[model samples]
Target: MPAPNPACASNKTEPSMLADSIDALLPQTQCRKCGFNGCLPYAEAIARGEADIDRCPPGGDAGIAKLAELLGIAAKPLNPAYGIERPRLLAIIDEDACIGCTKCLPPCPTDAILGASKHMHTIIADLCTGCELCIAPCPVACIAMVPAPNLTWTETDADRARLRHLAKQQRLTKLEAEKAERLQRQKQLLSKAKSAKNQD
Candidate 1:
């Protein structure tokens, strides 16, 4: 996704700008259980009157309450259509079973999966938000969601996850820009070569 507009960021009091703040309050799981691509998108939808604030299952009742308070509205139960609140979970890859097709890597919002193509992949538990976004893409069915051992979800954890999500987005954006520049350079070279051949 593109970076949030700087012009929009400057006007912090706008209703849509409030959505950016709302996005920060979210868990940054990027799970899409809220019927959107990520927490930011869902927050934007909420700001635009297109979605309710109670749609995040990862946020649970407490998250809903916080969102309600921010929006100055009554807190409601989490919409079951999205998902149910549960203990925080982590993705564990069965290394032996992992074919290492790298399918699970891209869906991870936090860049928690570490490995290269055709090599064994491992999950960085500390960075993982337990979004479960990586599981569905595993063609080998090696990924499993297990309850986070000896850890509880907290605002601090959410903050860390949010930071990781932002970093991942920035990395992806940079990669895309570089790719575009490379393609443009290739096009220019080809054009120059074609002109030279025509002159000859």
Candidate 2:
């Protein structure tokens, strides 16, 4: 038997636990403004001391403060290079101009966009995080950002976004695991064939 991987050992300062706590404090906008793939990745980076708390503009100064307090570090100002705090916005699609190519669908972390290939896509206003992730993928440039109506981002919104983001992550993890299993099975089959050929 081999020794267990130290990284996987149970410990008081487990990276996953720290990351989870950090992730819970995030704004959950799934915006790359933090220069990360999503809030969870950013949280992991923070847990590993590889990222700073001020990089998340969606969280703003208040959010930074929360993270700093959680990590027992001094709060710093939001890094301008990342982005500035702004009013929450929602994506609006020009239905007529939309080519319905569905390029924007996968980039949406929240699955807020509703459409299929060759069909006009629309944003679910309540779920939109204004991450601007879907805009660049649109070939027709039909998407625009507009201030959310009578809706300000609150902790409740963040909680919802966190759930959606987590669900997306879980789905992706499952897909990757399935792919790896398929590859392993294929390799085993090839190895068995080679062994039989050598014995013949």
For each candidate, how many residue pairs have backbone atoms clashing (under 3 Å)? 0, 0
Judged by TM-score, which candidate is best?
1
lDDT of 2 by residue, 30-147 (tens): 9989888999898888777667788898889999999877776678899898989988888999999999999998999888999999998999988899899999999889999988
List the lowest-lDDT window of 10 residues for candidate 2: 1-10
CA lDDT, every prediction?
0.85, 0.86
Model 1 quality (TM-score): 0.90
lDDT of 1 by residue, 1-200 (tens): 33333333344368767888889778888889998988999988777666887789989998998887777677889989889999889999999999879999889988999999999999999888899989889998999999998457777877887788889899999999999999999999999999999999
Candidate 1 has which clashing residue pairs, if any? none
Model 1 / residue 9 / CA error / Å: 19
